[model samples]
Target: MSRSTLRRALRAGALCLTATTAAAVIPAAADAKVGVSTKRLNIQTGSRVTVKGHVDAPGVAKLQVQRRGRWVTLDRDRTNRSGRFVLRKRIRGAMSSRARLRLSTGETRLLGRMNVYRSALASWYGPGLFGNKLGCGGTLQAGSVGVANKSLPCGTKVTFRHNGRVLRVPVIDRGPYVGGREYDLTAATAHKLGFSGHGPIQVTK
Candidate 1:
């Protein structure tokens, strides 16, 4: 081959080698070890949830929440000298699901659930409703503990807070069917939270 042709071929070979070596050196994303301030974060609407955590390595941390079965990044923070970060998100609507943190290396660390609650009026029921078939397939007995909502998916666990008492129950039946009321708490659930006739209650979706 001519000198120029030989030189071009040599350069092409060198470029191909470099690309292959670079590809070989690339590392796969790994699962990161991280610690957050809380495992289960509970907040009411108009309030914000603050997440403070430390990763094993210094990198960008993203706070992810689930929406429509997909993970959506809502906030992010850069690691400090100690690999610690703080992320915040204000609650606008009711949301309760598993949250996670993703690092810059694509490493993901499962944090915990973030429950956002909204205010609603709820009343207790049970007396005449016992032995009724629940919408989710079960019997609503006097001792059965659950909540009733007009639209929440069946078997959806709900966290309720009232009078400084908190209770977690599943959505087992249809709603109170009363206007201006959003929840119909079972007698057992209401009793557990010290709830009576039903006034203001906080519920997480």
Candidate 2:
């Protein structure tokens, strides 16, 4: 080839080699060692949850929670000299799934089972008490979504699941007040779950 053609070919070859090297180096950087953990697997709403984790290197880490089909920022912190981080946050909203902890380096970790969900035998009530004052404070209505528990503190959230349906409600009333019944779901809650009568159910507190 001519001198100019040879020079051009050499430049193109050099650029291709450089690109190949970068592609290999990029993946190595992405294979970072990072991990995270939570203080508890299950907790109540408005309670503080502690998150602790470590990265392979010291950097800023971000905490996020999955809500309404999206990931939202919960908190952020800088790792210590040992690449360890501690973040404490009060969970105020309803999150049905685990929270995510991600590092600036692209390594991510999951904090699974972050809230209370349980199984129980549950029945629903509403018509008789509709418009009547609940034991907690609110007036029961057809649209009210909640559960009645004999011992669980009022305002505690309860999630119900049956027949492939799910409903997250609050402990707004007292109880079913009958033997063998663990929870009494509000009319709206039962309707949402396509439940009609009593049966084996899942109730998360």
Which predicted model would earn the best TM-score? 1
Tens digits of per-residue lDDT, candidate 1, 11-110, equal: 9999999999999999976666788864436888778877888887888999898778999997899999988998888878888878888889887877
Instruction: Please list the residue runs of candidate 1 whose C-alpha ends up more than 4 Å from where it truly belongs after superposition.
Output: 1-33, 38-40, 133-138
RMSD in Å for all candidates = 5.2, 10.1
Question: Taking the tens digit of each residue's C-alpha lDDT, what string does model 2 give over 28-141?
Answer: 444557766545545455677678777878788887777668877778899998888887777665445667888877777777645644457888898877999998997998
For model 1, what is the alpha-carbon lDDT of residue 149? 88
- Residue 42 displacement in candidate 2 (angstroms): 13
lDDT of 1: 0.86
What are the Cα lDDT values of the candidates? 0.86, 0.77
TM-score of 1: 0.73
